[model samples]
Target: MLSIKNLTKIYGGKNKAVDDISLDIEQGEFIAFIGTSGSGKTTALRMINRMIEPTSGSIEIDGKDVMQMNPVELRRSIGYVIQQIGLLPHLTIKENIVLVPKLLKWSEERKDKKARELINLVDLPESYLDRYPNELSGGQQQRIGVIRALAAEQDIILMDEPFGALDPITRDTLQDLVKVLQKKLGKTFIFVTHDMDEAIKLADRIAILSNGQLIQFDTPDEILRNPANQFVRDFIGENRLIQDRPNMRTVEDAMIKPISVTADKSLSEVISIMRERRVDTIFVTRNDGTLLGYLDIEDINEGYRKGKDLVDIMHRDLFKIQIHDKLQDSVRTILKRNLRNIPVVDENNILLGLITRSNLVDIVYDSIWGETPAGVDEA
Candidate 1:
């Protein structure tokens, strides 16, 4: 948890990069700071890890003042990702990933294990671990950048326009990856971005700033429904303002309970359950119902001889929808990706339900034949 109180940063004694901004960020929340260029979103983020010393006010993490902590130790204890990525080209992927841990004197075995674990979290192959950063594509390198931040197992992550340089498709993929990672890891994320769509899609709360001032801080849904002022409303864009439509539904309204198995289930046990359920793919979950990954009949058949558990052969690369997301978003993704079913999860990656093709079909039919509801207007 982070508490920013009267946080202000001034440049050359007059220019306020961040002016009297204050925020209370909860654990595991994805918070995005957004504004036009020179609005101080990045300055506000850097102050948290003491990358930029605050000119005034204070920052506290779980009641401990960040100013009182050693800068190097504080930074190492918190994850930081940036657009440039800054991965050392000379180091191998594994080495780059565990660089912080190594600097902190982590054991070789621990570093190696952490590297492998993080690579998997981003759905990258372990074989890539031996390759250098140059060998990877831009998107691959960015994925590494993201997981490397997690290698230290820090509870808080600060990202400054991390996906800004990538192509739109790759950026979208990485956005989904980061959102899922944040939920699965239960880490607090403070992200700086100028894109409103990105903020609304990935953040639990969006903090809008202007001329270094904190304009508004609220959940995306709340902001969409009720922006604080004309500046807040205009900044978010008129097109994003939601219409009061009672017919509108969220993914939670349509999702059915998912067919899932605990990760601890053996391959044989999963196969039997799948056979009985007549489902090709089943969500693999941890004991707490965290959606760990997914297993299909093909995976079971191939890995059966290896005698591994469902978790061992499960696919971590899969699309999922948040329960509170608009049903239209799910429909768009399912149709675009040609998916059979997508898991629905809460903010914490807890398995809530699943939206199947049948569910989407029904929603589509209703949308096509039912009365049209009002929508956001073009600016």
Candidate 2:
């Protein structure tokens, strides 16, 4: 656990890099500080570990005043990773990874074991242990830096743009790896980044900074759906699509296949299917099996009361979205139409699955929250 109270940092004469700010970070929580250039996100992070001292206020690590601890001991107790990675050029990957444990006077056997375990944890081949930093790719080197920081078995990690220098694909891969590692290790992470998208994806709770102060600190969904202020609203922007698209998510990611029902049946038959499936709509299809309309519960009931046939009651002019359409688009559609669910079809008009309003909301919430809510499907 970490706590900051009225923290302030000033450089030289008058430059206040970090203004008075305060926050509480729970154990095992991944909190990201996000802001534009010169917003003092990095400065705030550095103050926590005394990489940059605060001009006033206090920082406590697990209830002990950080200012009272020896700089070397304090740093050793907290892991740190930077944008440049800071891997030693002369050291092999194994040596770099074990540097902290070795410095902390770990046994040779212990250090060696930790090195091997960490190398594997970062997905590096065993052969990479003896390789120098220069011999590895940029992404590999970055992973080595992470392993080195984690080698000391610290409970708190300060990551300042750890994946900022890598390619997009590598960065995304590393982000996923970090999430996995965080879940397994349960360490408190204080991450600093200027990228909003990364903050949204990685942070359990995002703290937005501006003019050397925290503007908003809340779950990502909270910030997206209800920004704290004008600055936050402007920063989040109007295009919600960019904020909710999951790179790995597809039509199959959130579809409910079992709940889907076929069309072209009689009113009584469709009602039976709906009751059995516990669904509100059925996918209408022609005799040859082409999608023709959507038979909703209301349509079926109204048709039965009016003595109309299933064909007459079915919504032939129903709005449809492709399976590959962004989930956010489906969310907007549901919200606008006040619908319970939307039908997902392929390009050929073949039914795929139903996306309920709750499902779309869950996807958006998970996108902003950095983790799926309890009982929600992974996307």
Number of the top lDDT candidate: 1
- Give the C-alpha lDDT of model 2: 0.82
For model 1, what is the error of residue 78's alpha carbon versus the real structure, in angstroms, after optimal superposition?
0.9
Off by over 4 Å in 2: 241-379
Listing every candidate in turn, what is its Cα RMSD in Å to the true structure after a full C-alpha superposition? 8.5, 13.8
The window of 10 residues in a row where model 2 has the poorest summed lDDT is 239-248
Please state the error at residue 219 of candidate 2 in Å.
0.7
Q: Each candidate's TM vs. the true structure?
A: 0.72, 0.68
Writing each residue's lDDT as its tens digit, candidate 1 over 1-379 gives 6999999999999999999998999999999999999999999999999989999999999999999999999999999999999999999999999989998999999998898888998998999999999999999999999988989889999999999999877888899899989999899999999988788779999999999999989988788778899988888775444321212578888889889999888788888899899999899998999998998788889899887766678899888888888875566557756889799999999999999999777666554544545442211
Model 2 scores a TM of: 0.68
